[model samples]
Every structure is written in structure tokens, then in C-alpha cells.
Target: MSLGDERESSGGYGGTGQTRTRLPDTDPDSYGTQRRGPRSSSRGLVTVVGVVVLLIAAIAFANRGDGDPADDPTTNKPEAAATAPTGKQPVDAKAAGIPTGYAHDRQGAQSAATNYGIALGSADMYDLEKRHAIVNTVYAPDVATAQLPDFDQAYSGESFLEKLGLDKNGAAPSGQTFVSRVIPVGTKVTSYSDSDATVALWYTSLFGLSGESSRNPVTESWYTTTYRLKWVGGDWKVVDFTQKEGPVPVGRDQRASTAEDMTKAVEEYGGFTYAR
Candidate 1:
């Protein structure tokens, strides 16, 4: 039998009618002594109908205001169109291991910026050859050629590598795993044209080493990066970019994960090519 049936069969309040009670009427004159007059009952019915009519009128008035709640400046409700998805399919091609073939529009520009942010912040960017490939794939030809040396210098410094617990070759120490990943939270197009666009990407990143003996355990940081993109060779390519510290939210009260779990997660879970 089901648990409910078993309970019913156990002779408790579920099956028995003994728990019911009939309270005494509030009107002493109508409690097993006298009946209410027809006039009094009719009056109560009229009162109830009047109250219902008032409630309906109030509701109608509330609904007939100047505009929708979303349009009202004082309301906290956001416009539906702001958050609605555009329903555009994600790009299905990659060039130099980065997503490519974005549409020539605002949404496409945002998509390009988002994916470029992820590529630039990834651990692969630490490797010189992979870094060069990313620079060429994501930047306009002239910009890439101009900035390649600067990028190389910035990422190749031994001091920078040592700070992140990596060796001169940007490889983690033996038995340790290095992690650098950018997860785009949102994207916005600040300005757009047929050939050029400016977009901003707000993102969080996981960086540092994950291992038992590592001094720099992987941690999260938030930032916003703005990209100036130009349509070059039929794709959105970065011409220039800048980054700043986050519009960070307050951290939650949660215990940190063990280094082993972090390392395992980084190894097991693959990242995504973000699009808007």
C-alpha cells in the first residue's frame, strides 16, 4: 500500500471523522434558538456583491494606468526586449582555433568581442607560438603586426611567469597544473557601423596554479574589457583594446575547494566559444 493509504488505515485523523468540530454561532439569537430573517440574509448578499464590484473596479483602474510597468521610470521592472534572445545561431567555424565568420552587425560584433576576450585570457596565450596565432587570428592585420612584439615582451618576461608559478617557458612546475580561463558574463555594443564597432565584455577569470605543493592556488578575478573592432577580411578583428578592474559583486560565504578538486575540474571540463 502507498504511505498515504497506510496512514489512512492506521486509524489516525486521516481516516477518522472524530476531529471535526462545529463552533457556536457568533450571533446568540441565531444559535439553535432563532433563525436570521430573510431581510437580513438579503442585506448580507447585497453587501458581498458590492464588495466584489469595488474589488473589480480597483483592479481595472490599476491595469488602466498610463503605461506598462516596464515603461514606468519608477518601476524596477526591465524592458522585455533588453533581455530577449536574438535567436541567431552560433558561429560554426574556427580560424586558428578561435571562432570566426561573425555576421556584419552589432550582435556579431559583440560575439567577436566575447570570444576574443576568452582567447586572449586563456592559458594558451602564455605560449609564444599559440599567442602569435591568437594575435593574428583575432586582430586586424596591421594591429597584429604592430602589437606582436609588445605582446611577446609582456607575456615572455620571467618575472611575470614566476609570479604565476610557471617556469621560463610558461609551463607549470612538475606535478602542478596551471589554469587561466575567461568566462564572459555579458557583452554590449557601445557603437556599431558596417565596418567598425566597439564592444565591451564583462568577464571573470580563473588563474594561477593548482596542486598540493603550489604556492598560488587558482582564484577568480572579475574585469571588463573593451575592444575596438574593425571588419577586416570579412570578419570582426580587434584593432585595440583596454581592460579595467570589475564592477565586482560581493563574494559569497562559501568554503574554498581543495587544490586537487580544482585541478581535476580544469582538466575534465572544456571551455566554450561564447556568442550573443
Candidate 2:
């Protein structure tokens, strides 16, 4: 829906009535980043498409944060079938230290699917070195070796960087810091088995193009990204993935923050291990 189509609607089964809001869908292409005279330009014309791309960047960066991905207790346990030897029950852990625990069976697969989704959509993918670290961390050893180079080529290409309005290595243009971040709102297990699973992640992504003369400026989007996961090398690793537009709600009518504030928030506030 277009941003101009935003409306408030409320009414439900419980009769308590719930109002649903939606973000305005601005044009993704027209805006160039040029703050007018130090005052933030209020061009409410960013597209819903841009938001999804930024979500990928956000998740990628957060995945590279401190601590070990393997050590996450939430997704690290063995399946109940393996533990029980009978292969009938499932295993699950909701431990605090874990990224987000899962049951040894389908639950574990679903959990893996969700966490992997976060990793895949993160910002670390922009940096070759960090991108390698993330691919290695999340994928099976063989898969990492074989797929890392491909991912490297795909994300590191000059054209790809330019498309996002970045330099050869994906650096933001002068005076502008790129903000591509994904915040997973929630996840759902669509299908699963003992060794595989498919999960749908509902998320909000932000992509910024904040400097003067920027070809690509900052924007936000909401969408659903799904990951098909497999149990590999004793952990859940992504095998395939895809993205789609959302059942996105309308955005707030609050005043937009300045470019500087947006930049600071991106730098200062880190992402989280999403749950529920």
C-alpha cells in the first residue's frame, strides 16, 4: 500500500477492539541524500523495499558482535531422539545465555532457522573479513568453505556496492554513514522434521544513505524473510532462504530524527538475540 493510503482500523473477535497502524510506503527511488542547510530534510519518500534491504544489513552486523555463536545455549543442545536413543521425543532449552534455545526435534530446527535468519540478514555481510567470519560461524565447515567464496563474490562485487551506493568495498560515501540493520520482530515455524526446518521471520529493516550527494539514502521497511535450515556439523545451518513483503502495519506520525541522531543511534545501540 502507498504511504498515503495509511488508515487506522480497530475491531475484533474479543470486542476489546484493537487498532492497527501502517507505515506510509514512500517511493524508494527518487530521494537523494542532501540535507538542506544542516537541517534534516524531511522527504517522506523512502520505499518499503529499502526497509527490507536495511534489515539484512542490521542483522548481519549484529551477528558479528562479541561472544561465540556456537556457545549459544538456546540452539546448541542435541535432539531428544539422540539423547533418548528411542528417537521418539524432542529436546528443548530456553536458557538465558543461549541465543535462543530449541527442542532437539522440530523445535531445535525452527530455532536454528530463526537464528540463521538473523545471521543471514545482518550487516557483517558487507565487510569481506567479517562476512567470512559470519559464514564460517553459521554454516557447516564444508558449506562454509564452498559457499563463503560465492557469498564473498556476490556481496563484494563492485556493482553490488554501487547499487547500495557504497564504494568498492561497501563503504558509505563521504559525509554519509550507511545504516542497514534488521530487527527481527518475531518468528514462526512453518514446517520441520528431525533434521530440517523452515521458519518465517517477521522483521523491520533500516537502510540509510545520510551524506550529501549520496546516491542511496537511508530508509526503512518491514517484511517477512524465510529460511530453510538443515542440521549440519552438529548445528543448524541455512541451506536456502527467501524474502517477501509484509503484512506491515502503518508507521508512526512522529517527527523524523535528524541525520546525526540517526547515525548516532546506529553506532551506539546494538542489536539483540530476538525471541518469541
Candidate 3:
């Protein structure tokens, strides 16, 4: 989400003036030197009164839902009706750095999808031990065991790391910054039930290397990753997930930062713990 990124003080106040003639305390048509007749003054007063009354009505209407959320739409709705979590709490516990033990509901399914997306696409995925931990913690137990061998080969194979400008050990070469990160834009619950739910997270992933000498430069790509969540052992776990290209928007013509700057930015920026 990082694209990569004053006050005026008044000198002096004018002194109060004392050169105007004071209007008479009582005069028939002398409210001011320009003079307004009583009838005109009354009309003016009525207009002012009307505006004040309207303002009061508007203020009251705006605050009508302030007292009780259950009694009003503006106070209770939007947040409740929206796809965002509906009063359900995100997991307070973590399993091997991944959030787990989600509530067995629609909100929990969406939350699990978001956190799983991050874990699956994180830079840590490049490391064997951490990657295995993530898959185990986020995936259904049986599936994690099954995917382990292939998962290791996919990330640890010589050609795989070489293609991404990384060593066989998954470390970037000297003077290069490795970037593998996914930023979840939002989540959508396409389907839900007591036992199962399907959620999709639309996200942008940054991958490749930040080195002028490297062939693969860090870049962003958009995809929607759908997760089929199962309510396993009182928590939502990913049974399977898939990614498809875009819902991509047209690229904005912005200045491209130098590789050095991009490296610095990625190094300094920390990833977010997202909840939907």
C-alpha cells in the first residue's frame, strides 16, 4: 500500500478602532447609520430565526441515532451490514506466527482467509522451516502433511531460487534486497455455512529482487486468492486456496524509483497484521 512518500503563523493582530459614532440607544429608524425601518428589522429577525430553527432541526436529525444503536439505522448499519467483521473478534492466538482459532462463522472465515493470504505469500515463505510452519498452521492438518514435500521442492529447488535472483539457500546476494510480500486490499465471503465457507482476498503481491544488477526487479501484481475454509476443530482452516489474475486496474503513470531507493523502502517498511 506504500506508494512511497507545513504551518502559517499570524504576525500581529489589528488593534481595536475607536473612531465610529455610536448609534442612539433609541431611534425609530436608526438601528445603524444606514438605518433599517422596524418592519425591515422584523423581517431580518424572522429570517435569522428561520435559519437557526433549520439548523437546530438538522443537528437533531443527525444526532438521532446517538442514544441507541439498535433503535436507528445510521448508528447500527453500514458497519454491521458491510462485509467487514460483524462484532466477531479476530483470533487472539497465533500458531507458528499465523493467526488461528478463528470463530466458526462468516466473519471468522473472512478473517482466516486474510491472515492465511499473508502467511502464504510472506517473505518467510522462502525459508523452509518457517514456510512449513506457516502451511501447517494455516492449512488443514492432513493437507499440510501431504503438501510438505512438494512445498519444499517448489521453494528450495535450485532453479526456483535462481529464477528469483536468490541463492539456493533463498538468500539474496550481497547488495540486493529480496522482496516477497502480499498486501491484502480486501476480503469477500462468496459463500458461507455452518460447516464451510469460501472467502476471496483481493491482494497485491511484491516479488523479485531490488538490485540494479539483478534481472528480476521488485514489482507489484494483483490477484484474487480464494480459500475454501473448513470449520475444523472449532476453528476455520484452509482446505484449499487458488489464485487468479486480476480485477487489475490500469497502471498509473508514476515515476519509477531507483533500485537503491526501492531497496531502502522495503527494508524500512514493516508488514501489517490484517483482519477483515
Best by lDDT: 1
Candidate lDDT (C-alpha), each: 0.70, 0.57, 0.67
- Write one digit per residue (lDDT tens) for candidate 3, span 1-276: 111100001111011111111111212222112211233333332222334444443434655634666677556545535565445665689989788878777777888889888887777877888988988888788877876775675567676566566788789999888787788888999999998899989987776677777566666667787788888888888777655666876454344677788888898988776654
Instruction: Give the Å shift of residue 262 in candidate 2.
Output: 0.5
User: Lowest-scoring 10 consecutive residues by lDDT in candidate 2?
Assistant: 1-10
How are the candidates ranked when ordered by lDDT, highest leading? Answer: 1, 3, 2
RMSD in order of candidates: 28.6, 18.6, 26.1
Where does model 2 exceed 4 Å of error?
A: 1-103
lDDT of 2 by residue, 56-157 (tens): 434223344477876565456566554434322322432222353344566566556556555655666677877777666665566667666556655676
Cα deviation of 55 in candidate 1 (Å)? 33
Candidate order by TM-score, decreasing, is 1, 3, 2
| Most accurate candidate by TM-score | 1
Q: In candidate 3, where is summed lDDT lowest over 10 consecutive residues?
A: 5-14
